[model samples]
Target: MKEGNVISERFLLNNERALRLFNGYAKDLPIIDYHNHLPPQEIAENKQFVNLTEIWLKGDHYKWRGMRTLGVDENLITGTASDKEKFMAWAEVVPSTIRNPLFHWTHMELKNPFGVNSFLNKDSAMSVYKHCNELLSQDEFSTQGLLNHYKVKMVGTTDDPCDDLKWHQQLLDSSFTAKVKPSFRPDKALMIEKTQQFKQYVQALSEVSGIQIKDIESLVAALKSRVEFFAAHGCSISDHGLAALPYSYVLTDAEKREFESFLKTDGSVYSNPDAFAGYILTELSKLYHEKGWVQQFHLGAIRNNNLGMFAKLGADAGYDSIGDYKHAERMSAFFGNLSLTDQLTKTIIYNLNPADNEVFAAMTGNFADGRMKGKMQFGSGWWFLDQKDGIEKQLNTLSNLGMVSNFVGMLTDSRSFLSYSRHEYFRRILCNLFGTEMENGQLPDDEEWMGKIISDICYYNAEAYFNLK
Candidate 1:
């Protein structure tokens, strides 16, 4: 029943209490976003967003999935609903999403960006919405302005080979405050079973690289050229999203030739999807090692099997679900295959299934040489695991099995701008974990040491791991 105050002293914490201890460690640390899917062109142009809804709610499948779960229609999610209406819908559902990471992230965004101290519900939605929309129109809320406000030092954007790198070039040419680098993601190109799209992509890549793609050899050459092009533009990493680790037995030249011949047929090669994907991943890993680039494998996501929804809305419209793949032992074989030949570059493995966190986390350490304690990383909690519970589990698993002090930190892994609040969410959960541990005497109660650990997880590790300046 009390009126909400925008900036109450009650919310302020001086450097004297447990909350103070956490905030002191958290505040002002630079963000090193090692992997994300932000549109580089937006960053290159320093684009100003139209409103909070446009920036935050539009392209985020996480929120969209929640909205659908709450019975909001797809029209509102990906179709024409005014920003105000969509935000109101989000507000209505926000309270019900308690115990979900979205609740924390939503409040954090509101509190940090607009200084709103109240919860988002039907009653307070309009007030909070109007306040954020107004702030978004200000010069201080531009993309560059927001990154600067967050103290982000660098961000790695997922880019395809067919990209022209014009936006990356623009960032390099201009004096941007934050460094924006590209991460080559060749999934769409490598998954050649999607024939029509694959052929179109080949033509696009060929045109971009000025190479004629008549056979598998030329296709590999074209891909190689694009990789060099990406590296020249400051890309130091390559990312692949797969359902599981690539563990196909080494293929013979005869087998590869037969596969290529199949591709030249009806343009549909779904007969042996795994063999083709495995072959491409091996070749891609070879390329990664040749260039000394860190390779990221995001495995265990099962995507878009709902034909009706897929036909109506297309891919990534929130139809994807998690897979129950037997990941651990197979993944060991995959990484072992790469390790035996000493062809493994610095690798980061992100598992979608939390059940395998311990397995994956422990498995990653086995591949790490003592020379670099954290060279091969167990990536942050991803997809469904991006929330508080998920992040905590991952951090704990890594802390128990590996070194949390050497973590690569939080990545948006997002398609929307408002998702930056994910970093703050991760920082808060991280601090809370350390604070509780320190309070319970599980860890030593030393602020300076804890501060350094917090900084390392939030920023430093990614910088050192990626060799980002």
Candidate 2:
């Protein structure tokens, strides 16, 4: 393989059939990134990055964490360092990230958009930076241009209920080809443990929804109003990030009263955090079902572990890690309750901890709706589990427990425009997995038939699942 072709044309494809499936079925398929953290405003404005660091290093906690691991100075990582200096610091850590996904991601990103086939390292940092910076200065390197270059058909950006979605509206009127929509993410609304923060969030929610949130009923009403508002703005999906699925079907009336009391006071402690979260999430899920929206739960992440670094850098600063939690019961209770009521809409569950793979996969089977093709989806490998082994494990598990043919495929779940290479990464892995099966005769030695399945998992399934025609 060439220097920058580290993830070559046949990087993960091991056989001739694998290569054929990748090139013929998956390579040029349009991307519909159904969930991600990319900023809608950047796409609306078509913002041009000034340098390599600004585009690649900024807000990328994956690189920041790697830099910190190398004992790189805080100043160079996220402090008041020059952009070039930060790029150099990142390049210094690139070679050290040999077995890490960042290593593959870095070179693939360079090779695709910027056409830099040289490997990135401290020795080659200056030339790579200068070359990439020149490319960044081009109009084709702007935000919208990058999305277009990657053949992105649609992107669903994570957004708060309090947002006006003005950027999404702006994109609607613009000539941008790809559809940019919002996914309602009201995680903070469920955080009653953070009293002041919750209060402030509720107040903002009230202001936006034009409804006073004095109690649980009013709070739900306000959230419902926002849901309707979001629906008007072309949002048909809701996302939640939680350490575990919170569920409590037997909370005492006194506990509910305590929640009401806590809401009215600036109390130092809220003892009913679990019940409150469960109650609010249930109500929200009902609203999601009513709206015919897909509800996504991203579970098992213990976030902001290092308080000192958290205080210094804040949330999503690379301090989060996989968490262990008993998920089966709560997941069953939550979905089973909705299922019983005939209120379970299309749903996708993403597990951060790979240990819960079987649990999540089996649980999706328990609530499968016969009406919808892939209603209960065990989503693609996410966060800490989006790499080769993770992807293969998820696919194998889903295939064992359910129909792999109906599986909705890869999502960037990323915060960068250049991360579209991840889709390429995922496609190559998918083709390799199926094609290798064909080679071994475990599956039929058929290209066209298997190619359809590969293309479906890569693109067609998601298009149908999300109703993104």
In model 2, which residue pairs have backbone atoms overlapping below 3 Å?
none
Winner by lDDT: 2
RMSD of each: 2.8, 1.6
TM-score attained by model 2 = 0.97
What lDDT score goes with residue 461 in model 1? 79
RMSD of 1: 2.8
lDDT of 2 at 151: 94
Each model's lDDT comes to: 0.80, 0.89
Off by over 4 Å in 1: 1-20, 267-271
Error of 1 at 348 (Å): 0.7
- The window of 10 residues in a row where model 2 has the poorest summed lDDT is 1-10
- Give the alpha carbon lDDT tens digit for every residue of 124-204 in model 1: 888777778888889888888888887878888999898889999999999887889999998887666677887788779
